[model samples]
Target: MAAAARASARARPLAHPNPGVAALLVKDGCVIARGWTQEGGRPHAEAVALAGLGDGGAEGATLYVTLEPCAHQSARGPACTDLVIAAGPARVVIGQLDPDPRTAGEGAERIRRAGIAVTVLDDANARASLSGYFTRAEFSRPHVTLKLAMSLDGCIAMADGSSQWITGEAARAHVHAQRARHDAILVGGATWRADKPRLDVRLDGLEARSPVRVLLSRGVAPDGVRVINRPSQIGDLEGVQYLYVEGGAVAAASFLAEDLVDELHIYRAPILIGEGRRGLADIGLTNLADAHGRWRASEQRQLGSDTFSAYLRSR
Candidate 1:
C-alpha cells in the first residue's frame, strides 16, 4: 500500500477531477504488476496493472491500491471495481477511500460483495498523497501551496521591491521542479509586472509538465494566463488539483487571510536585507496565539547557503 501511494505521486496535478491512484499486484510477496493513472485520468491504475498481468495472472493474488477502486462506470472508462472483480484477486488492500460523491465507499463495498477480502488502511503518507483530491472534493477548490523566498531578516526584497535573486541557483532549480508537480502556477499582478516570469517548467524532458499559468488579478493581464478576480472564485478553477502560488507579498497574504493556503514553502537565504520589504504582510491576526496552531513545520533542509522549510496547515 505504501508503494502504491508513491506510484500515485507521478499521476498527480494531471489527474484532476479524479484522484491520483496507483495499484500493485503481488504474488507470494513478489510484485507482479504496478501502474499509475495516465494523463487525462483514463485507463485507471487498476486497469493498467491488470493489462500487464501475464499468465501467472491475478488469480489468488493480492492487490494493493492507493485509493478504493472507483465504482462509477462511465463511457469514458470502464469501472475499476468491475475490472478488479474479474481479475480474481484474493484480497484488496486500499490506502484510502475515494472522496468522489459517486464512489465515496461504494467501490470497496462492491468488491467485498463479490467475496473478495477488502481492507482499507489508514496512514499519514496515504492521506498526504491524496490531499489535493480530498481538498477539491471537500472544499471545491484546488490545494493551494504558497512558496515564498526570502532573507534571514524576514525580507523578500530590498526597499525598492527588487528581489531578483534571494536564493542560490540550487534553490531556484528546486522551485522549478516543484512547479512541475502542480496543476497550475498562480501569481499576482504585482509579480507579473515586477518580474514578467514565464512560470513554465524548464527542467529537461519535463517541459510538458509546465503547469497552467494563472494571474490573480481583476485588471487586464497577459495574453495566455487564467485571470482570477477573487480568491473565493478559486473553486471554479477546473481541472486543477494542485495550485502553486509564487508571490510578491499581497498575493500571498490575500490567500493566507482567506484561509485558502493549505501548505507553505519558505526558502530563506543566509543574507539579510535589513531595510527592506517584509516577506509577509499583515494577516489581520489580533494575537500571536491565533497563529500558533495554524501551521506545523513538516520539513526543513539546507540547500547551500539557503534553508528550505515546508509546513502543512494544522487543520
Candidate 2:
C-alpha cells in the first residue's frame, strides 16, 4: 500500500476529476507489475497494471490498490472492477474506498461476489496522497494549502514592505515544484500590486505545468487571471481539486480566519527583522486555546539555509 501511495503521487493534480490511484500486483512477495493513473484520467491504475503483466499474469497474485477499483463503466474506459475480476487475482487490498456515489461500495461488493477476497485498510500515506480527491468528493471546494515564507522573528518583510528573497534558491525551487502540483495558485490583490509576481512554475521542463493564476479580490483582475471575490467562493473554482495560496498578510489571514485552509506550509529564514511587517494579519481569534488543537505538524525539513515545516488541519 505504501508503494502504491508513492506511485499515486506522480499523478496528483494531473488526474483532477479522477482520483490519482496506483496499483501493485505482487506474487510470492515480489512485485510483478505496477502502474499509476495516466494523464487526463484515462486508463486507470488497475487497468494499466493488469496490462503490464507478462507470462505469469495476475492469477494467484495479490493486488494492492490505493482506492477501490471503479465499478461503474465510463464511455471513455472500461470498469476497473470488471478488469480485476477477469484478471483472476487471489485477493485485492484496497487502501481507501471510492467516495464517488457511482461506486462508493459497489466496486468492493462486485469483487467479493467474484470469489476474490478483499481487504480494506485505513492507510495514512494513501489518504494523504488522495487528499485532493477526498476533499473535493466530500466538499465542493478544492483542498486549500496556504504557504508562507517568513523570518526567524515571524516577519514577512521590513516595515517599509520592501520584501525580496527570504529563503534561498532551494526553497524557491521547491515552491515552484509545489506550484506545479496544484491546479491553481492565488495571491491577494495587495500582494499582486506590490510584487507583480509571475506566480507561474519556473522550473525547467515543467514550465508548461504552471497552474492557473488567480487573484483573491473583488476588483478587476488583469488579462488571463481568474478572480474570486472571497475565500468562501473557492467552491466556484471549476475543475480545481488543489488550490495553493501564496500570500501577503491579509489574504493568508482571510483563508485562515475562515478555517478554509486544509494544509499549511511554512518556510522560515535565518534572519530577523525586529520591527517589520508581520506574516499574518488578525485572524479573528479571541481565545488562544482555540488554536491549540486545530493543526498537527506533519513534516519538517531543511531546505538550504531555511527550515520548512508542514502542518495538516486536525479536523
Candidate 3:
C-alpha cells in the first residue's frame, strides 16, 4: 500500500476528470515494476505495471494498487480485472475500492475468487489522494472549487474593472498548478470579455494541459470557448470529474446560489482596494453566521507577496 501510495503522488497533477492511480509489482520482497496513470487517461497504472513484468510477471508477485482494479469495459481498453486475472498475481493490496457504479466491489470479488489474496487499507493518505474522484462519483457532479485572488480588504478588482496582476508570479504559477488538477476551469462572462484569458497550464516539462474553458454566459460564447448557462448544464460534459470555478463576483454568486461549489481557494494579497469589486457577489447568504460552517480550511501558504488559502466544503 505504501509503494502504491508513493507512486500515486506523481499522478496528482495529471489525473483530472479521472482518478489518479498507481501500481507496483513486487516479487520476493524486491520491487520489480511500477507505473502510474498517464495523461489523456490511457495506459492505466495496472496495465503499465503488468506489461513491465514480461512472462515471469505475476507468477509469484504481489500487486499493490492505489484503487480497486476496474472491472468494466470501455472503448479505451479492456477491464483491469481481466488483466490482473490473466497475470495471476500472488496477492493484491488495494488502497480503496472503486465507487463507480460499474465496478464498485466487483473488482475485488473477481480478484479474490481467482485465488489471489486481497487486502484493503483504508487510510488518510489514500482518501486524500482520491478525494476529488470519489466526491464526484458520490455526489453525481464535478467536485467544485471556487478560486479567488483578492486584496486584504476582499476586493477582487478596481471600480473601473482594471484588474491586473493581483498576486505575484509565484502565486499565479501556483494557481496554474491547481488548474492542472481539475478538468474544467470557469470564469464569468464579464471576465471572459475583459481579460480574454487562456486557462492553460504553463509549467515547464509539463505538457500544456488546458482545462476546458467554461464561460458562465446564457448566450453563445465567443468563437472558440465553452459556455454553461445553467449549473445543470454541466452534465453534458462527458468526463468532467473536477470543476474549478475561477471568477468575478457575479459568476461566483451563480454557483453558490445553486449550491454547486465544493471547495474554495482564496489568495489574499497584502493590500486593499476598498470600494471596488468584492470577492463574491450576493449569493443570498442571509448573514455571516449562515456561512459559518459551510467550509473548513484545508491548506494555507504564502506565495511571494500573497497568502494562498484553500477551504474544503464540510460534508
| TM-score of every candidate relative to the true structure | 0.96, 0.98, 0.88
- Cα error of candidate 2 at position 32, Å: 0.9
The residue pairs found clashing in candidate 1 are none
Model 1 lDDT-worst window of ten: 11-20
Q: Model 3: runs farther than 4 Å from truth?
A: 1-6, 9-18, 26-31, 57-61, 73-75, 205-207
lDDT of 3 by residue, 1-315 (tens): 766777786776476556889998988988899988877676789998998877756888999888899999999888989999999989998889998879989999999999999898875567667776776677777778899999999888898887887888989899888887777888888888888888778887543666777888887877667888877676665678778888878898888888888788999888878898888888987788987888888889889989999887777
Candidate rank order under TM-score: 2, 1, 3
lDDT by residue for model 2 over 231-284, one digit each (tens)? 999988998999999999999999999999999999999999999999999999
Whole-model Cα lDDT per candidate? 0.89, 0.93, 0.83
- Candidate 2 is scored at a TM of 0.98
lDDT of 2: 0.93
* Model 2 stretches with alpha carbons more than 4 Å out: none
Model 1, C-alpha of 210: deviation from truth (Å): 1.1
- Give the residue spans of candidate 1 off by over 4 A: none
- Write one digit per residue (lDDT tens) for candidate 1, span 1-315: 778888889888677667788899999999999988888888899999999986549998999998888888899989999999988899999888887778899999999999999999875677788888889878989999999999999999999988889999889889998999999999998889888999999889889999999998988867878999977778888888899999878989999999999999999999979999997788778898888888999999988889999999988
Top-TM-score structure, candidate number = 2
